[model samples]
Target: MGGKTVASLRNRADLLKFDYTHLYGKGHRRPVIAAVTDERLRELVLQSRSWNHLAQGLGYAASNTKDTGWRPRVEARINALGLSTEHFQGRGFNGLAPLAHEPVFTADPTPERLRVAATGKAIAWFSERGYTVSLPVEPAVYDLIVDSPNGLDRIQVKSSAAADRGVHCSRTLYDTTRPGSASTGRYTRRPYEPGEIDYFFIVMADGGMYLLPYEVIGRSMKITVGARYEQFRV
Candidate 1:
């Protein structure tokens, strides 16, 4: 495929995957959910309370067939076809509901999952306001590149679910794993430099979002998203 086509396909896949998790909740069932295309089959899968129940309804032999086997095959088929599962719910094939003001996050999610949830919310937030959002093909300083009316803006997403007095957003990147980085094995804190990112999109513990320009909060190692920052809240 051409470069633009590949990127377009990737962007669509990412959006669909995010929508699915946002609607159905994240779990291993994604492939199976995406693979089953028939409305009747989808209804059966969603309405049925359990996987075993779904298997039985599909006419798999309860004695001979392992319920676990079916899901992988369905996922494999979808992968082979290069198609995402269509969301069958009333919302649409994407299964997206109106974006909630605050996205729901799981209890005590790991740092990586938290980052992903925040980024997903950021993408939806910008997209809802009529901007085109794209993810970088390789790792970069910014999390998302948004094509807005003004121009393309690079967005760095930060999230904090832990709060004492306020949500704490770290402005520096840490690389503790690098060998000989420091005596404490911690890399020096490096704040984002000028022109590195156009904006900082923060997701707070309460699900409050803030989109602030880089110039407004420059070179701070840590920013507390509290009352003082209320004006930037989105």
Candidate 2:
């Protein structure tokens, strides 16, 4: 969002730009919100074009600051994630779906059900710290592989949902069908660099979980619920 672009709903101060969406703690330049992560806002709410331009094209607002009730807490988090801001009218991907004028369908909990609730809260947070974790029916890079009592490593289960105080996740996605691109699939939030894994059992949005490690994560991190990393609480 360095280009600083946000144009569309221009009125009540652009509906006060989603009450400064939330999430801050590392380099505070201001950009309401882009992705704190509920699977990168469900892959940018299915490539938003409506939903009033998905929080300013996933960069929230670019200044001129405004925050008032944040549209009933982001429509109570899009009706508690059941979603429906009522926009579309159809025209073959005109803003990309969501306007059939019906509930459509939902039971919530997707993205592999919050990635199996962040791999069952990081395997009950390392079996309550006593350690002895193992779950790899098919993990190749890293998901969970601890045999620690002080040994084996590799653990990466990050999760995110809360956005007002911080917690929106996204490793990648925004292919846009590639081939000459521009169709817009947008959603490139990042983090996790060093060798890709050594420990990072996040999972926030209130159910709280930490356990970070891997050089205190520095790929432009912003996570901040109980800052100080709460001694890597589980």
Candidate 3:
């Protein structure tokens, strides 16, 4: 392989064998390695140059280290942006940007868990009100399970700053029927049935909160472009 070809293979190897148990702790041994598309990865590679400039205002570093306390907070912020960070492992360059080692945050461990925890907190927040929530006996790994005296509420929690962008929606609205991008679609699509859940509670990463009507989220998906901050209008 030529120099560039060899380097590309090395980067791919590093991505597959990237280790993070040292920083995130033993609890993060098995992380989900999301298969991003070549286009997306290329876009990220290009954006990595500007990420440092963007991340600084967001309180993130351009590199990963044991010292940066920003990992947890950055993870939380990404969750608010509607991107699945449940699989974030850490943040650092994958060696594919303008700089030999630009900063790229790993999400296999950071973003996804925060979303689950936030959702759980939102659900528990409602359960504490003496509702009839059951914690979802089916165990769909949802954020919250709230059984109100009047009805039931299945909630997914999210946290985001004023800068993150992108929002996903589906037509069926059922967990099994959610739409996905065929170009880079690697996750299991789900159906988003509105009748199944009474409400979608979106807790903002910036301490703002909203009750998204099921109908609104189930009808369509939205992507934020050329912007930094956005709120889900339900």
Candidate 4:
């Protein structure tokens, strides 16, 4: 994305600037399907704007990368609480929303659904592990909040999935919306004004619920079967 922007379907003439797009086919006038074949070229094409662009074209704010010294502790919590991807499914968020559970929605039947299911599962799963789950919190209908047993330790919930690889992944984002701020962080809203939460989590379902760090999945994060997990402290 740095210097590789491409024109839309109608403005493909710009592609002729590169010899890479015309490896197999004789001329650049042919469609890419007939022109490109080499793996490297294919990778370039794959990494091309349209190929890696998120299924959902939403823009995202960069996550705070400063380590918060919480990884070892969080990992320990995950281990002690048995928060594996497999265990945090179906029932993880059940305690918070009880009767009103939202199933992962997707246009196609793919692993994205599993990621959605796993996210909901992580909420309920954490709650069952003694964490408190809160949902439909005021100001944001799509928001879910999780409170760790340590009392004040809280995590805001947000889920994402990409069917490209048949997997679903969800991550917790820090809410940076405080009163009177020009804008909020990835998960904060203007209504909260200067309101912000310190820590964030990213959970995905490759095989089960793996809690990832917010930074790893920040920009254009997509859910896929083989998507790797990234973790950030604080």
Candidate 5:
């Protein structure tokens, strides 16, 4: 005689298959299906409620990947979160998932490239003006320190994908937006302040750079860089 059917076995055990593509894209490992531990299961249970939010938390696209190889695991989570799994394949959700999705963030696709190019240009600009540059071993409040004939100046290097506007200078806003939950994080403009940074060094998407003093800017978020601010361009 044969053993119990698949549905019966699943009902008797915590045997759900998760693709784990959300963690690592595909082909890195074989047999994505595996039994999750109770602890891991608990953490997953506490994750964002809405499917869109869950996808955001997973760092994956929600509109797609619904009928993926291991959607059963997602179904398990959806069920646990009290969401109906019907029509999960479609954009139209017959059920709304939980609500703990992380803040959706937009990042430059090639920030490292911009950083390297901009840093090189900044070094050249400073060297031409008779300044010695020192890079930090461990990144801190500032990425570099400059020793000029005038004096020492501490600099914070910021890179942005935006070429049309200045880069974002942000600070986390607390005790304002969401009242109860701290999971919701909000980023706002935090202008350069005296004693915090002597200069704001910015690198734009097109490899353009600016080395502006703190006095030039006010106590507002965004440090404008372009033709007007290009006087300080490196």
Candidate 6:
């Protein structure tokens, strides 16, 4: 009584007055705050379809100008947590989809889409086989670098749907100053040289896969996957 003043007594009374849950014998209320752990952030990233989707999950309004810095902050946090932001960027989420169970294409996809799909399949294939796969930070001749028990192998992936009873793989890189015109504009096709890449990972329309050495495939402009290459099927 000597130590407790009027203010203290009033505060205690207020606390008791608000403690109806305890008096009613109802259980304690659930925690209002949840810790944002690295695992939770990674789960959100995986579930997010795009950057804006991720930002919204983190409590930032999509159209709010004040939230403009959220992306950089989130990227920094992801890096601090030892996570890669690649999954939050282009075509990364596509790899997370059920590519194996996807329906057959009714029409041909754009070259870029096809490339992304093929790369996703290649990544899954290597990952399932217990090999460590990584992408180049900068543009390189090879699409993937695979760390195998034998050694590191540079893999260039090529994909083609079955056409006229065969899978056609382009073995050359082309550049055109003017697209859609063969005449009056510079058009060049450069074939893959020896020692450029160790292997060619070919994905066919029917889900058939093959890994062939560059030496065996040579400088051919187009290599058709047929009965002869069946030995290389993986």
Tell me how far the alpha carbon of residue 84 in candidate 1 is from the true structure, in angstroms, after superposition: 37
Query: How does candidate 1 score on lDDT?
Result: 0.67
How many residue-pair clashes does candidate 4 contain? 24
- Give me the runs in candidate 4 sitting further than 4 Å from their true place: 1-112, 115-119, 149-205, 213-234
lDDT of 3 by residue, 42-97 (tens): 34333443333333323223353334444455445444544443332345533233
- TM, every model: 0.48, 0.21, 0.35, 0.29, 0.41, 0.47
Candidates sorted on lDDT, descending: 6, 1, 2, 5, 3, 4
Candidate 2, 175-200: lDDT as tens digits: 65455536544545566576767777
Residue 33 in candidate 2, Cα distance off native in Å: 49
lDDT of 6 at 169: 40
Q: Please write out the lDDT profile of model 6 over residues 1-234, one tens digit for every residue.
A: 333574576578697874322121112111101234577788877777667666556554445424455466667777787765564555333323335565776777554366569988999999999999999999888899999977999999988764743533444344565475565444555677788898899887677889998887877767778888899999
lDDT of each: 0.67, 0.60, 0.46, 0.39, 0.59, 0.68
Alpha-carbon lDDT of model 3:
0.46
Single out the weakest 10-residue window by summed lDDT for candidate 5: 24-33
Candidate 4 has an lDDT of 0.39
Weakest 10 consecutive residues of candidate 1 by summed lDDT: 19-28
- The sequence of per-residue lDDT tens digits that candidate 1 reaches over residues 1-234 is 476885686589797774322122213344535545665464565554344455554544455335466667654654565544443333212322356587666468554466569999999998899899999999898999999877999999988766553434345455777777465566556778898899999987566899999887776767777888889999
Task: Write candidate 4's Cα lDDT for 80-120 as tens digits.
Answer: 54444332224223212133556656466455465456446
Which pairs clash inside model 2?
36-167, 36-168, 36-169, 37-168, 37-169, 110-113
Error of 2 at 34 (Å): 51
